[model samples]
Target: MMAGTHGQLWYLGMMEENKLKTSEGTLEKARNSEEWRCQGLSTQRSCHFMAFPSFEHVITMDSLCFDSWFTPSWLDEEPARNGFAQDGNRCNDHALPPDATAFVTILRNCAKNKDLRKGTKVHDDITKMGLLEKCSDALVTMYAKCGALSKAKELLELHISRNLFSWTALISAYAQQGLGKEAVDCFEKMQRAGLSPDAVTFTSILKAYGSIGAADKGERVHDEVVHQGLLENDVMLGTALVDMYAKCGALAKARQVFQNLSSRNVITWSALITGYAQQGEAVQAYACYEQMQSEGLFPDAKTYACILKACGDMGAKDKGECIHNEISRQGLLANDFVLGTALVDMYAKCGVLVKAQQVFENLPHRDVTSWSALIEGYAQHGQGEQALKTFEQMQGGGLAPNEVTFTSILKACGALGAVAKGKQIHDEIARQGLLGSNFLLDTALVDMYAKCGALAQAQKVLDELLLRDISTWSALIMGYAQQGQCEQAVTCLEQMQQEGLFPDAVIFSSLLNACSHSGRVHDGHLYFTLLSKKYGIKPDLEHYACMVDLFGRSGHIDKAVGVIQGMPFSDNLEVWSILLGACRKWGDVNVGRWAFEHAIQFDRENTAAYLLMADLYAAVGMHNDAKSNQALRMDNEGLKMLEVVV
Candidate 1:
């Protein structure tokens, strides 16, 4: 009995030892399998169940267990009969795979399709299988692609062993969402983790830098690309490099990379063209477009849009019309609202309001941009009533006017001196909260008030602005000048200079006009001298004309003649007319006759010269010469009327 009891104890002890060894072996196998899975996941391709050799037997067993769960017949069954239904509970009795590779595949598909609902369901399955920690990177990628950035960030933070794939996923998510600075921060953290970024990673970060105009960061990344030799044989990276540099306003570098590229596509060409267009290098943009066509690369909708913008910038109406015809041929305008808007803007900027309206009316859908473009064209062309009508129509169509729209319409009101309309627009602008944030809008408001002869209102708007640019100061100064408030205009000029805002040609023109209207000859000469000497602004024809009017208005005929003679260009009949008008004003017949003869000699059809000469002759009692001048003016007027009639 004792020997039998001892044998039983030994047997029990041996059985316990074998059980312990078996448990240790299973735990070791699981750890090894996890490490293997991670190594495969770290590769470029998606992680597949077959990639994990250690888990193959387990996956095969799970596949058998869940064979009925994924069958074609099951997929076609009703929601209550299928185990894979989004809300069904038929699969609750069966256990899913430990690694959840099948669900991961489904999540990847959901991400590709951008289906958040299915992705969420797959994530729930992953969580229930207790595979969330292992499959965190896949979840991040899915959430990122689905635009669920918040959920992606949560998963990224929860994952402890955040590898290159994990970091790249988050960085890409930030970039796609236009969170450039956040993407850069993630890139820095990734580098600190001692993992080198691949070409795709570099491209994503470059896009981020481009979107935010972070040229400094983009340059650093370019250096990295050079060091890694990643630009060779990588067309996508090369295109991204070109796009980044172009968008960052480094056109020279962009061109260098583009020329050296082994391959060039429409995307790179369009990027370069867009850069030139945005920089106002319209000639270069057109040249690039022609060159692209010569190289047999057709323009896409974006490329066409960019070139149309270039045409508008340069006022190349013929080029714009040609592009319009091409776009119509391609049927691009039928469905592409952006392209249609570009067409409208191009026509409006080129001073072809009729064409702009035709295109606008033909558009299947018109956004605020289309309406704003037409309104701006009318305003710019001094068609105030038409602009207001268009604004009302836009409002009637239930489209809210944006800042550009309001600015255009306000300008129309100012041009027509419609004070009531201007006030109503002002209320709307204030209600939109656009006044405080945008200096341009505020300047527009001041200009509107000033143009309407409401100097006090203009001054109030100027004073309330938190920040003021040269345009803001110039607008108020011009307002005072137009209202003959010469003292206030000069004071504003002094204040603007004291505040370190250097006056440009526009401000100088306004100042000279103020002096001319107020008969401040000395101040006009002083400002004219300061314009050239202090500010280095060469006087254009407008400035010279203002000076002639200033001298002529102040009873300085010889000084006015001196200005006309001193002008660099001699064919300016406007200046001569100013002198002639000044002679008539002060009754200097000899100088007036000389000015009239010279004006007619320069431009034989100058009606102002003829009219001024007739008035001067009549003022001095030269009735015969006055009749001759009047007859000549009548003949000119008859010819003009005939031309119009024809």
Candidate 2:
């Protein structure tokens, strides 16, 4: 009787095994059939299924066999067709698990399918069926696909019981969300939870560290990677390390790491190159690019862009042009804004404005930098009118000029001393709310007004500045000095000193020039002494020239000559000219001869010296001496003074 019961049980088990095999075979065959498609038919899977081959094959096979044979007539009656597969809940109770599994498989497909959305609904239905705990991997995967990382984490904590794929999915989700810090935190928590990181985990976290420039944290991770014996000389990790070090301004360390790379792709080379370029080390940048090509590593669009910028800074126009031709040969010219901009700036800096304008006009989209480059090009060439016209055109193009643009325009105004135009630009800058921009613009405005002989306007901008830099003070001082406003310049100088800002050589030079223009000889001498005594600023040749001019202009011929002779250094042509001019004013032959001889010796080719000596001899009625000096200048040196135009 026991043998009979055992035989009956074996027979029933065999029947169930056959049923399961038939069910699976039917699903596979239906999926593999060529008739399956997503034309006008309302099916869960379609021709788009080809993108996810695994899911497509399974869904097609299951739909063909399960939908027709086992599907309830009520599901077909309620919807036109394919309703059961579309809404997995329409499946009978026995088919629910297979349907849920199918939906999960579709969710895991990386081929970007519209059916993935339906997979989300099926996943929710699976949760309702209480199968989520039983199928933790599937639930975690579904939540990850739907971008419901919190739900994914909840399922991982509650049902996963162990993190194998769960850690990877969670880390990747964090990375995708750009929560790099959160990704690192998750990685640390995973380690605390006793999970060993895989290659994917390390790569993802390394990327996070690189993005945030967490150099110390990245180094720690690198040490852990080496300690774990997971350092496999992978190019991705090397690239990440280079990027991290580069972003951190540790170019030396970046170079060390980059050199240790056993193999480098274009990205590795490009990262190191860009790092050097950004640090203003264009020579190193180009050298690496050359080495990359020598290694037979071809450059892409990004590589070309970086190298072009390096070339521009280093003034390697030949190299830049060669790269330009290469870019054109590669047909990468259309969408390359960086390369285009770099080309414009390169040509502009090289003084090839025509070429720069051509490049600027050809750009598919002209950004602010493009216009700024062209405007600055004109400004630098002293084409102030052209620069102002370009600025107007740029504003008309619906592009508001930035600080750099305004700075260039203001500089042009200063160069031309176009006070009205400068004020208009100042008002426009204020209207655009860029008053508190860099001190460069403020300094430029002050310089413009000062050069235009508008000291009050210059002071207006000066007072509005919250904290003035040295250039601000220098601008106002130079303006007053140039206009012979000695008192005002001295006042500004005092104000500058009271602000605890020590003046440089330019300030002193401007102050001395002001003294000369205003005939403040004593004050000029006192300030020259103060430069050395109070500020330890040894008077340079310019200061000496100003002092000589001060004394010479005041008819102190002997004092001027003494000042030139008493100079710590040998007398230059400027000092002799000042003394000679003073000798002419005072009509002192004794001083004039010495000054003329010294002037000739200091500047052997100075036509002015010859002319001045001849003029002095003529003034004293020494026609013979005058004639001899003139003959020597003409015959011995082929020197001849042309008519002065200005």
Candidate 3:
């Protein structure tokens, strides 16, 4: 290390064993006056370095992400060196200014290493020496790179003589800090300064647009980059353009740009994969991952994480296991707790609980996310005891549960009908002030109470919620439905509509389920109609099955068949099985035959449908027909069917 006074300013550099490394540091000036007190880095302003650790003796600096060519305005502004005349002529009675180049060098080095704590001392010296005018650009670059963004912006705006590098650095920093609008504003100001942005500046601004989902603005930047022909040579810039499009959900355009790129790397592929995974396009994400590997590029940690999420989304347990093995072989799980957490979440979503637990236990470290993944798997799969035990273990390890952990624990409490435990968890959440803040926790609490058959408590919690979304109201209605209060659930539905929340497919399914259980077939039918007509919500398979169940249980076998006939898609096994059960209840042998044939066509191994049809025939005294189905079911090659009695 070297530190000494050069005029009033101190020069310092970092030294490692057998090599000199450039870093920003300064000697603490004695704070004797108010000016010094205001500029003091702190009371302990001295540099703290017992001994510099050895490195490869190769201290590299980041490339300048701005125009390398400078305008000659700086060269033409050299100060006068002669003695001053009476008519305000320039003079040089002062010997000379301390070297500006040395200060700039140290500041640039600080920016490279992000050495801000020491950089502050450098800033303090720069301010005292009145070199702010000459070193404004380097100071801004140092402050911006070191994460002191506000200070960087203030310095840039204060110095009208600022260069392109100063504005570019601030713009890049603002984008990195996720202040997209601010970064855009800074870029606009840069444009107004009559300076053209280079390739790197456009890349950073594209990231800014991506962060805020400003695809339109990003398109303009894309056009500018194209007009300048910068994309032909800069692969990094091309990747940024693709990333911006993907983040804005303009995935079609993103794919077009990605295909047009002459070269691709792991980062470009990761961006595309991340977009697909986040947008719930799991198949596309998985396909992209395979293609990236096929291009002879191995998946990085980020790519693995994205692919694992895709596998979880698709419930592809086999693929997730393959990824798990690949991750283990690469030893990526040893230090990357985030990757470890993703693995736990992947296995858990696949319903491979034992493997999830094994991965979690073997993790080198565990955070709230990893513990939440294990606990959530248990809760989701109906292993309430295991969920509760894991929750306790997480707390025992001195990790306070976050919102995600609480949500999973609440689900476990609900599944086990542990109302007391649910209430205790609710109190803990209230104490932590999580109730009004996150709607997810609110929904979880209401659902927990409702699942435990505590309708009044559930309703009370819903009423008191500071924020209520569809999921929150749906929780209360489903609770009422589960308790067989069909009328109350319907009333809640009307209330939710009055609040301007149209029912989604899930909500409609819940209502239909409640109506079916309580024998309100007409109400269920009305909701099923509104699902498509009024709400414009295309009924999914679950909704269709719900409607079938509703009609079947009410002895409306023809109406159930009508619902199946009107389905725009092909019939599933559950739909046919429900209709067959209705036929058994009503002694409708003709319809039972039709439903049994369709069910077998959809899935030859639909044992539930076979059983229902066979039972209906035997109940109707069609002993021959019952025996025929039983024999056919047994001889159906791979089908496993229970023996029937006729």
Best by lDDT: 3
Q: Which residue pairs show collisions in model 3?
A: none
lDDT of 3: 0.78
| Regions of candidate 3 where Cα sits further than 4 Å from its true position | 1-103, 132-139, 153-161, 189-196, 314-331, 436-442, 464-467, 583-646
lDDT of 3 by residue, 388-426 (tens): 999999999999999999999999999999999999999
lDDT values of the candidates? 0.77, 0.72, 0.78
Task: Name the 10 consecutive residues with the lowest summed lDDT in model 2.
Answer: 5-14
Give one digit per residue, the lDDT tens place, for model 2 in 33-84.
4333443222322233221233223334432222221232221232233221
**Model 1 regions lying over 4 Å from their true place:** 1-110, 115-197, 211-217, 314-318, 569-571, 624-646
Clashes of 2: 2
RMSD of 2: 13.3
Evaluation by TM-score, superior candidate among 1 and 3: 1
lDDT of 3 at 313: 88
lDDT of 1 at 30: 28
TM-scores for candidates 1 onward, in order: 0.76, 0.60, 0.74
